[model samples]
Target: MLDRSRTREGHSPAEALRDTVEFARRAEALGYHRFWVSEHHGVPGVAGSAPTVLAAAVAAATSRIRVGTGGVMLPNHRPLVVAEQFGVLESLFPGRIDMGLGRSVGFTGPVRRALGHDKDDADRFEGQLAELLGYFTGANEVPGLPAEGLRVPAFVLATGAGAGIAARHGLPLVIGAVRGEEPMLRAVRDYRAEFRPSPLAAEPYVVVSLSVAVAATAEEAWRLLVPEAWAMAHSRTRGVFPPLRPAAEVLALPMTARERSLFEQSLRGHLFGTPAEIAESLDALVARTGADEVLVTTSTHDRAALLDSYRLLADAAGGR
Candidate 1:
């Protein structure tokens, strides 16, 4: 997990990075197995803009936790660059690195352009994923290969149509369970049925990334997440990026009925409540999808609160 959301007291990016390092150290101390940072372009609230760079920082700070993206949107950059970056990370961290790649742009049009990518870039993601794998396996023969013959574990992040690709590639698959249990279960079943063993993976592996925020009380967790709900609602109507505001402040703003619906739906896959409540939800999620692991993504403004949430979750989940 990554400490992602912006601080209301105006913390600098350097401060945020240091806080993230400390957060990773705490999570490692608590016995979490892996720490994954997300890549989001042009999002004001999320400071994990470059997951690879952040992964390096976290890796350098913590000695044991496996660190990687959860994930890096493959269509946004060249696959070779990604291969080289992860190669270097693998060199530095050895067996404690994992790469999770996704096909979505994770942003809107203007921001995508600023990142040197266009809408149609997603169409080439499958081919690029293959090329990236080849680079890691030292099978790709492109000019000026960086750290050839170095293999790093890689996984694919899939939602709808991309599940088949994960099966075909035989890479560990992570499904976004935002829709519901039915879709996620079906997708997992399909992936397992179609899986072919690869050198990196002897059997099918599934990780479901779900939204969760745990606190001492359900209402407190819900109240803290209202700002996230509001930001998601604003994004559906106004586009990808939105400024952060206090939950109370966001709730006071006028919104249409449809916008309200979108807000609720945006939080559908999330488990927001006390530790016991979140644990029950997570247990159901794991039982339903049969996921090997669950990657949690929390949306909160306060860093300490975010760390506390994970601490509760770790205790509830019976540790690593």
Candidate 2:
């Protein structure tokens, strides 16, 4: 599960962070394999701006579930600093740390300036990623540093040129359920075909990430997606990305034609339905995409229902 630690209406950012730690505990109990937090800067809706720090909190909260970023934007920081941070995390947590990474710079111009990076910085992701990974193998000038020789596993979040980069590096690729399945499928096939064996992985590995909601009825499941759908629409229509609102409140909102269009479009890639329905759909999706793992990133105003959805999904998958 990849949680942004989304702050909902009438909720504090501190509460959102605490909720994420609590969610990790619940996910551990429910037998989920991995629990990942996300990174977002200057977004009023998201509280997980510092993924490594939040990852530490989540890691300390859960004993078994693998904790990591879903991921850290490589463009925003130097590779050495990131390696040092993850090195500290791996040193503390040992085998349970993952280093999921992305190449996004920032959300807007102000954010980019604040982070001391521009969009062009994202183009250097491949080199930065290599340098970051090299530290674990004592590739730096000074050997046996904090990050050197630590075996923290890394996964790449497939953004612009991420598929090809992951292929060359032989790291696990984490991709979204794209607008059309064909484009995503082609990328996966290309990644597998071009895969180069390395210490990280011998064969191509793909993790498909998406929003999933399970409930007794399809309408309820769809309703659980409303908050995020509305946030999507709002972000596109307005420059600001606000916190999540209740499903009922969002449903009653007055939206323009464009807002409605984007809202519906954002809802296309998500999977929400009854347990049996979701199970069959997910199975078919995995078969189609050849996914080694499925990472659910569902968020909703109702925490109880969100957990229930995960519980039903686990039961449907026959639990751990």
What are the RMSD figures for all models against the true structure? 2.1, 1.2
Let me know the TM-score candidate 2 reaches against the reference structure.
0.98
**Alpha-carbon runs more than 4 Å astray in model 2:** none
Clash list (residue pairs), candidate 1: none
Q: In angstroms, give how far residue 225 of model 1 lies from its true place.
A: 1.8
The TM-score values for the models, in the order shown, are: 0.92, 0.98
Task: For candidate 2, give the lDDT.
Answer: 0.90
Candidate 1 lDDT over residue span 82-195, tens digit each: 988988898888889989888887576778878887777887888998888888667777731554677678888887767888898888998876577778788989999999
Estimate every model's Cα lDDT from 0 to 1.
0.79, 0.90
Question: Which candidate number maximizes lDDT?
Answer: 2
Error of 2 at 263 (Å): 1.4
Error of 2 at 26 (Å): 0.5
Off by over 4 Å in 1: 2-9, 12-14, 143-146
